[model samples]
Target: MKLRKPVIWFGIAMIMVMVVTGVVMFMEKVNVFATGTALSDNGWKAHFSEPLAKEAITNGYVYVTDRDGEKVGAELVLTDKGRTLQVEGLQPGNYTLRMEQKAVNSQFKSLKKKKVDFIVYDSIESISSAADLKLYFERAKDMQSVSVSEDMAGSSEKATMESAKAESSDAVGGGDHSSTNIQVEGVDESDMVKTDGDYVYSVFGGTSVKVIDIRNPKKMKVAAEIKPNDDYYPTQLFLHDDLLIVLGDKMVRYPKRSASQAEIMPMNSLTTIRLYNIEKPEKPVLIREIGVEGYLKSARKTDGMLYLVTNVHPYLWAMEEIEGDALRPRIFDSNEKEKEFMDFKDISILPGAIDPSYSVIAAIDLTSPKTSQLETKGFLGSSDQMYMTKDHLYLTALKYETSTNSRGAEIMIWNPGRADTEIFKFKLDGTNVEFHRSAELGGTILNQFSMDEYKGNFRVVMTEGNMWDERNPSKNHLYILNENMELTGSVKGLAKGERIYSARFMGDKAYMVTFRETDPLFVIDVADPVNPTVLGELKIPGFSNYLHPLDENHLIGFGYETSAQKNPSGGEPLILTKGMKISLFDVTDFHNPEEKFTEIIGGRGTYSPLQYDHKALLQHKKKNLFGFPVSIYEEGEKEFEVDFTGAGALVYEITPDRGIVLKGDLVQKKASGQQYEEWETQVQRLVYSGESLFTLSMDEVKSYSLDSFKEISTLKMK
Candidate 1:
């Protein structure tokens, strides 16, 4: 009997041990690895076997850390009824996801701490098929929804203002005359006016392109007028050899509807290029017409080939109904019978770009215009600015990042009050443009001049943060990248609290101007692509909007002069613009640059188109002359008011020995009591052929002798 009692007690002890083991095993199964951990677009997700404690899914208990154990900036959300943890804003890097004890259900108290080591990819993979493309857009659409509401409130007004600014800003040349003020010596950019030494072609009255014979400036006459159909409006011109190319916008209307349907469909816009045989200037012959679907962004001609870039934003939200090519950009060539949509194989995704727009690039072989040798490719992204050389083309797109607050809620910010620029490079070979690679910079580019390619190295200048916001004052930076678009070296955090106003890259040097209360011209040595350093800085009381190289040792700064004024509201002193300022800088000693001479025009409201458009300035290098059109305004009796004095083209002889000497002024006589500029008489461009200079306005073309500054003759067009 005693032996039986001992055996029964042993069996009971064994049974209790078995029960405990089973319970522990079941608890282990209800952990975070129930499904699996996976990466997502800009984030990652962890699946749990059982629901987690709402309070435990926080920055304290559940967080992401770098390899060095530093907490990473991310947003955590409890999704799928608290069974899933979503962490977002985690860039591509090695990370360790830590889930402390008690992060899961409290019932499983024996749970130990969990740590997951993984890598976050860039998620910038290319689309391989139509399904992949659709999925990519679907995800993009969902992501954009979070911030669309906030963006919509101000988008329309902002877009209108930008459109107006773009329309107002824009500019040609050649003899012993001025060529279009181009960035590259050999590469030519399209402008509103173009000259071939003997004749000047210009877009007049925004309606037609007029060919003016400049062989005899005093007797200059309109040789011919090339007018397109009413559907097209000419904007810019390009002259190569005996071929004249006219670029404009054409309105495409929908098919006519029945009488019962009173509503009309919206019209679409296209960029049209018309090539003319100008062998006989008296009667130009239109040889070919090419139409690309979008608004013209930029165009360049080099190595006997013409390249055109346009941005197209399709109705992607209607992709479900409009299938295939209907959602793609199309191109029409006069050589072909019908227009065709770009093939899917030719459309590739832009790395790091999220915009659902297409940047279409078309290349035309001017060497054989009649043969119709044209190549067009579309990239799924949006381009704000374009810079090109003889061998490569570069495009820039701005990208914004979504951030989280202290509470881990996603908030719409301007990429934390700043934007990043993504640069894409394309190889150019005759009429072929191939995608090479891409890279990113830390700020937004001011304009096309902000980028340059030199000696197989690409140099860029950018401005970060908002200049108007004191809390986040802007800072400038210079980045150098290799041919593959990889960062080779950088000069960062330059000109703190100021923004870049103008930038220019010379052979082995780069000049940048940043402005706030004063202007600082930074001269940087870029001879060593890996270690660029600032050689010198010149601080003055004004800013330069454009920088032109007078020679290897001198630079011309064109901008506005300013004065500090006592603020009526009593904060920071108000900076009041005084007048147009032109500065001649001598960089003979790289380490000691000097503003050799300065010239200031009218005061207060004085303005000139040359401030915004580089092509507006005519550079007669041989004669040491620089000239631009200006509208003069001086401060009046009332505060913040100015009276217009006159409008004219001013020519100055700028030299190191003799500063800036005003050679002549062609001011149009204003009517009695005139207080504003008259558009008809406002000079728009200045060009010189042989010894005669020509001034073009909306109403007439006038010629003046370079020797005496006397008006020779005028040809009225209006």
Candidate 2:
């Protein structure tokens, strides 16, 4: 009897020990640590001592909630080898993170805390000077060993305006000529097409800049060509008076010694800016060549000053041993033996941003007779988009909270896919560019049109969440800020489940397009800057990827045509996209907006570059001419497959009275070698010079009479 009693006591003791050990194992070893104080575009991450199971971090257990106790939708991505939890989709607000007593680790044990608290501040801190930039780089270097978050890796690789003679009657009013679509009245936007009232400058075959003399349409020929050296290829061009600016990249491949033999190593990308005096059209004199270590992100020309932005990814891994001068970007004057790197003092960065990439802004004064000198400023971040006004220049970059090695702090972070935008402003004072102010916003912008400066208030449109996500999907937002880039008023949670496809700001009104299954064109009233409101929305069959303003009351949209089909076993209809779509929207009555006209071209896989690149669109309001390069594709015998048919320029006459009328199709005669190939003779641009219209293809430049649409001449590009 005594032995039985002792056995029971021993079993009871073992049970007690097991219960205590299990309790300890269930307890969370690490507290949730967050990096930034606010929730940013790249949502902040929550770091636990040990990675919890992905299934455990759910809306029911681990999530943020509003003051009303409503759960704020967020995307939780397990990163750092399942050790860190990345949280996205949380907007700026005070919220409680509720982790139930049952919330467990990877082993399915409960967390120690029943609930945790955190506040998503309204804004993020921005850097001030070069010293701040240095510190940011220092921190990014220290975090080299940390794994890059998947959410951060998924953030898109960070992949502008008019001039006055642009508003002339021949340019805008009631003229029979077409011009490059521009943003501002006086600022000239660089394009594949630039007409100086007599000649056209077009990039040919992505190899040379061809000057076409349209003075005599019957004999229009390539007057001159500037073929860059083998190392550099010009992609975009800007013309001011007699000076033509060519912007491109210079890639240098050099031999590097390996363990056994010498190997050719490709150097870092270098942005190449070449200034040429084209006063003598037949011969362009290379006046200056500026080579900076970076890829040209964007550039703008205002008041004879060219503001160029370049994003340079330094050899950060070997930054310590790199030559100090090599760390800076270099500029070489024409005929000068010495190359000058942008001074260290000229580089300044936004504070708190952890981007290792350097954004260099260089301002060149075309008005100055001394073309050798250019003022440069550098920022330590990644630039995705840029917007420039007559007085100010805005460079926007996105930094995800989950990006690897962005900061030096040892504390694990809570950054998910949420991103924060850094807006760096520079004052355009005549010929000099001066750094103005830097600010931060939460969310990712679409493009240059996503940002606008109205009445001293800066307005922007951003998208949150994953576009392909079906569970917690994407949404759009419109934010208004003062000159300092501080958020004043915002209208968020728009088009929930849809991502922004296009945005356009005209004066006090902004038009935005979002898409998933259907396209919702939202008209926002920002006249009150402080209280921006969504006036109305027009749902359409397809989405617009680029929006162009026809007037104060009308907008022209270019995108794709989509149709939805129900599955045999129904859930959500499968959306099938096809063709190229153009829409004319009338917002004359804010309350009753309508798609006045819509035109779908081709079938299945038909595509237009203009849908993805605004530069491909050529418009002339006065001439009622609108055209873009399109490639026709037909559906094949197999489902979801297509075959190329033809490529050309589709010109349309757009007018309020007549609507959209097909002017004519302009196509280039195929090259002699590949004449039968469908890809041959693909027209890329259309330019109007006087009464003649010119269509540019890789193989040739064809001219047509504006009135008759008859081929006037064909100049072989080669």
Instruction: List candidate 2 segments past 4 Å from native.
Output: 1-138, 144-178, 253-266, 318-326, 335-339, 369-372, 402-416, 468-471, 667-680
lDDT of 1 by residue, 190-287 (tens): 88888887888999577989999989977889899887767899998888999999999998743224443234544667889999999987889989
Global Cα RMSD, each model = 11.5, 8.0
* TM-score, structure 1 vs. true: 0.79
Relative to the true structure, how large is the alpha-carbon lDDT of every model? 0.75, 0.68
Candidate 1 regions off by >4 Å?
1-138, 146-175, 254-265, 316-322, 402-416
* TM-score of each prediction: 0.79, 0.79
Clashing pairs in 1: 171-192
